[model samples]
Target: MNALLALILAAALALPAHAMPDLVILVRHAERAAEPASDPGLTPAGEQRALALAEALAGTRVDAILTTQFRRTRDTAAPLARAQGLQPQVIEARRGGAAEHVQAVADAVRARTGTVLVVGHSNTVPAILTALGGPQMTEICETSFHHILLLRPGAGWMQLGYGAPSPAPAAGCL
Candidate 1:
């Protein structure tokens, strides 16, 4: 018994002092207006939602913020970036493809410690999650604005709703 206990203690002590934190938070851009030019900014409700997101994540130790170049994505991440005192890094969302963008973002996140927040669009959120080795999920609906995806590589992923409940899906919708 003494020998076994000594061996376990020695192995534990040989590990690193601290393991890397693999946390990634993903959210789709807040709601946008119907009447405006292409790439219009967030709507009033969307602005409020963005602020709500900041409040929700205020206590988290965010090391980085990533977003696409679109106004909606940048605006959505602005509040949280300001709150965390980190500038949002603009990565090409659709440069090569969803998989390529997601791979790059995942690589960047894995290389660092602490948490990361990525503001993406409905079409790209699932791709990001999938790229990070998360389980497949349904695409974010057009009317769904409150989905918050929490991903921890090697652990798992969870879908959380923040701010207000997402609007009901259209009739006969999937």
Candidate 2:
């Protein structure tokens, strides 16, 4: 009985004092210009939105930032990364199959403490969120650039607008 009691106490002590909720902030890369190159950089408005994103998240304690290899995603996350004194880690964007990449990112996030920000394209944002155990969301529209999706694993998810509120939805468009 004493040996079993000791084992129980040891196991209890080994567990974390408190489990911290994982906070994942996912955003779609800011507006991009229609260019001939396969990967185009951000436009002037996109630049402003990027800065606005930095300001919006300045108060939060972001432990890490992740972005795809593309310029647009990297550029969108640059300001915040610089402000937080963190270099954005480059993750591969979904090409053929995103399941592996998404699972890898989700695992990395689960192993960390504090908040994490992932800047991805409109098409990949929803997939990332889903992989992180968040709700399924529609693809972000080309013209909409201000949606910020906050995911707390085991808790819930919420969508908030940052920078400039997305232009009022077009008529007849939900």
Candidate 3:
């Protein structure tokens, strides 16, 4: 674990001071409508949740946003990005599996400084959190979208919830 943190920190050292973040915020994208499954956008409820996310972090200084190319992730990040007057950097989900995707996102994040919000899918969020030096995390419940995973150097991980509470664990997805 020490070696991993050292490696992550070493990679981050080259970035400018303003780009070096003391905190990294990771979250699964908000809810999605059932139609057009390939690249579904946020549902009305999800939009509200996104706004809630923006409001939740309004007081904090977020210097950068990272998101996948998917519509749901982009839409989920939109509110916060707009609120901060920053564009969310879109990292393609890419082929090669979850580890590859996680590395891509993690590397992109390491290159920047300041606080950042990474909008990833349920499957990706757990790995991304771990890569950012947070604790090992299982995927959020499929129905879950309210979890906000916060990580800072020497701070470990803290889980917080915003917007509507997630429904109890059940089955399937939209």
Candidate lDDT scores, in order, read 0.84, 0.83, 0.87
Candidate 3 lDDT by residue in tens digits, 12-73: 99765643468899989999888797889999999999999999999999999999998999
Candidate 2 residue 5 Cα shift, in angstroms, is 15
Q: How many steric overlaps are in each model, in order? A: 0, 0, 4
Off by over 4 Å in 1: 1-21, 170-174
Candidate with better lDDT, 1 vs 3: 3
Q: Rank candidates, lDDT, best first.
A: 3, 1, 2
| Predicted structure with the largest TM-score when compared to the true one | 3
**lDDT at 144 for candidate 3?**
92
Per-residue lDDT for 118-174 in model 2, tens only? 898766788788887898767777678899999988899998988877776554321
Best candidate, lDDT: 3
